[model samples]
Target: MKLDNLYIKDDTRNPTLSFKDRASAVGIAKAKELKKDVIVASSTGNAASSISGFAASAGIKNYIFVPKTAPEAKVTQLLVFGSTVFLVDGTYDEAFELCFKAAERFGWYNRSCAINPYLVEGKKTVAFEILEQLNFKVPDYVVMAVGDGCSISGAYKGFVEFYKLGLVDKIPKMIGVQSEKSNPVTRAFNKNTYEFDYIPPTTIADSISVGIPRNGIKALKAVAESGGFMIDVSDEEIIESIRILASNSGIFGEPAGVTGFAGVRKLKKLGLLKKEDIVVTVVTGSGLKDLKTAQ
Candidate 1:
């Protein structure tokens, strides 16, 4: 909270109104390159709607699997895009596994964020855009909510690629935030281990309610190698952050999307963030995506 400069990379303005659009766009392109006509994906809400929208625009077929508890607004988006939607009656982890197996069995291109390497390549563009918007100046810290871990990992990869190309002199510390009720990545970081056991998520932030983070190792490495840390915020904190961000900055972020800002406040309270540091927190999705909780 004492940072000299604080910025929010508002991805809610994307075509699909979420940061997942970045990866979904790439996935659709990759499916074409592979000569695949049908793409399959699993998500809580954001990724499903994103891929569904892109697939519709591209005239390609898409099948989406999401937990039955996914926000109605997101489900409506999928239906509007004419995607084959399966409301899986289980947790997000179960839906992901189901989609994974189905994709393999049916030879459909899997667009799941954590499983597809190419999708992460798409996600890296967020980092590129952030630096470009900042006049190619890297911030002291880059914060984002972590679910299956692909987004944060991709952001870190982007920064490292830019650093390798001398586009930037340094990589910002990659701070990952998760809901305390669904915090496998944060738990692993706290334990100083990469291996984490599955812990059923019970968070109100459906977008980040991942029990078994599919890309957990990469996310852990991203935080550790960047000399950053992982943190968890309560659902109450996430809700308060949504209000704070909207009222203070006029940025309406969903519960999960604003989780990083919650972690930032927590870190400041814990005396971990410095007054001189510049910080950037990514708002991954629009508040409209989960209006029930936002209200």
Candidate 2:
């Protein structure tokens, strides 16, 4: 793809090696402010690992629930961070429900991205950074992989906030990418509906394999209100993007992390992206987080 200016907002460089760290940082901080001692969350991998790492540094107790299929590397990170890990013998959605109930029962602060409003506050900082780094010049498009939809919504919120404050003239079109094998949001957008039915996801991009997106409404609004569209890419495309991004840009990312780049490629091939358009694709996680899949 020969776009005029395509930038990669590489969140893989975060402390916990994923974009989830931004949310986790805020979640942890909120828990401390609330005087909560224990925090709980459910994730495919990144969120659990991120919160666990931050909680460790903050001396806060954390309980993480992940599906049995969660990548071993992430599980190891959770354990290493001293979190009480629950490997739910079911899908991520099941794990999420269980974690939610557990949090309520135990009175632990829930840090799951979709359920917590404050987490998005931290995630929105990505938009601020992108604008600041580019000397406040807004890009034509901002793309990222959508999991539970919280990250994309956060980004939209950030841009909107900046616009409200007259810090920027316009907000970029927010493009949300999903795996073809697990694309409820894309399906909903294509159908022009806001309500999305649960479609059990079976994608190799574990981080984005959400069947029932908790923040689906906000994500759909982000795409629609910003004059953006949702797109789904094949797993093969995502894997290939990992290689392409690394070989060309020296940026190594996991499958889900590179999904946005894959979408950018697809968009260009489909004639949706103009050659003169400035685009930024957010690489949300490090390849090291899922070494086996990357290999």
Candidate 3:
């Protein structure tokens, strides 16, 4: 469906409630080849649930580390999937460090975004699906929220690869959105520097409140190469985006999912967008993943 100068589609049935299934789908395939026993990953929400779901399907044990600040709905989803959960008193970055040490100590397969190259393989499929569904026609822009940047990077890679394979004629520009308070990437992009000092705990956007994005450097490259722009949106704008997406497009997405729309709105207000422009903004997760934020 089309909404707000962008095309929106639902990716709700990938066994997990969020789009991280695409990452886990490929991670599981690689794990079998490595003959790994345990799968370890760090997530604020959907990635943890997805890893647990896929691990069970592949008969592998799963360990998930998450910040204590994560939303309850996401924590509950991971619990219901029977993942071995570790709640860290520190931030998401600290939880990532602990998971990294554990993975190295136990030789567990790592599905974390920054450390795992194959994780992006699964996420790339979403872009492939979009292009094929459009019958080889490429859009002018593809928008998505940037957390670790894995998903946006994956989608951009998919578009370029598909173009090389004669599946599509061209690659679309990528528009990346990050939470204003927690947006290291957007800060870096504007400053043209690699140094970014993260702020303290924030309730602005829980799904994207990481102090430091592990894949900051690569995520910047994705935006630069795709001829795309990155912007930050306020918590207020994100809340409004959630309502607008659900009401206008018949899609119930979390704040992170609709933040891309918030960015698109920024472009339109700046007179950088047109009504006839074919754009795609990804709904990264179901609204049920964060009911409190949705409400």
Candidate 4:
């Protein structure tokens, strides 16, 4: 198993400065093809910003509803990129719900996670890129942060579909990370079911502090089907991992992005991960999005 640490598709080469660009690329293309004018979304940070920037590229008007608690740096991107931004009065989940209601009531095309199947379809390209970058080699483990689970589900689906296409040898065990306070996915994974109430909110990984994970069932299945596992990290660990990653690998990752490393560390401590194991941990967004956390 070849361990390739350098990010290719997840690299910061996208114009919008985030991995969500992969999904936004497809979303904007499809929305343009469908002739949708107004695009609406809700995000804690990167997802909405990505779509907002991409919508601008497509000459489509963007409406973003983000939690007031999301980092100012992220909100700044939306406005600077020329998208209309709304600061929701509640949590990210509340913000997402408001966006969902607006999409239904105002007939806005929702590009939000899980709520839109198209976005998931777009986000799934990460797995395809990983496959191609690896020269059709599937890693022993795939680690990532879990937000609304659209990207996780999308990437997992890509692997499943790729196997069907005879493009990949097998699917990797997918390990998803969530903030300790908002680890419904991890809770469900440990409890061996999807019916769990663990969404209390968190501070470290804002992008993934999902109270009630939208794609709970599918997200759980993605791990199980991939012969993978799930884990959680405290805000402190997530923060420390940022500096650790930057110091060791020169990869400056935000708290959300650092969750993958947190998972790697925790798995390593538990002796669940082998040193020879080919592990690919996805750093989802640029650390610059939340400079305070990294500092």
TM-score of each: 0.98, 0.99, 0.95, 0.94
The sequence of per-residue lDDT tens digits that candidate 4 reaches over residues 28-130 is 8878888989999888888888998899877999899998988888999999889999999988889889999999999888887677767777767888888
Q: Which 10-residue span in candidate 3 carries the lowest summed lDDT? A: 1-10
lDDT of 1 at 86: 98
Kindly list the per-residue Cα lDDT of model 1 for residues 60-80, writing each as its tens digit. 999999999999999999999
Task: Give stretches of model 3 more than 4 Å off.
Answer: 1-5, 201-203
* Top-scoring candidate (lDDT): 2
RMSD of 4: 2.2
Assess the local accuracy of residue 261 in candidate 1 as a C-alpha lDDT between 0 and 100.
91
Ranking by TM-score: 2, 1, 3, 4
Candidate 4 off by > 4 Å: 1-9
- Between candidates 1 and 4, the one scoring higher on TM-score is 1
lDDT values for all models = 0.93, 0.94, 0.83, 0.81
Best TM-score goes to which candidate? 2
Which model is ahead, 1 or 2, in terms of lDDT? 2
Q: Kindly report which residue stretches of model 1 are placed more than 4 angstroms away from their true locations once superposed.
A: none
Q: Give one digit per residue, the lDDT tens place, for model 2 in 159-250.
A: 99999999999999999999999998888999999888887899999999999888988999999999999999999999999999999999
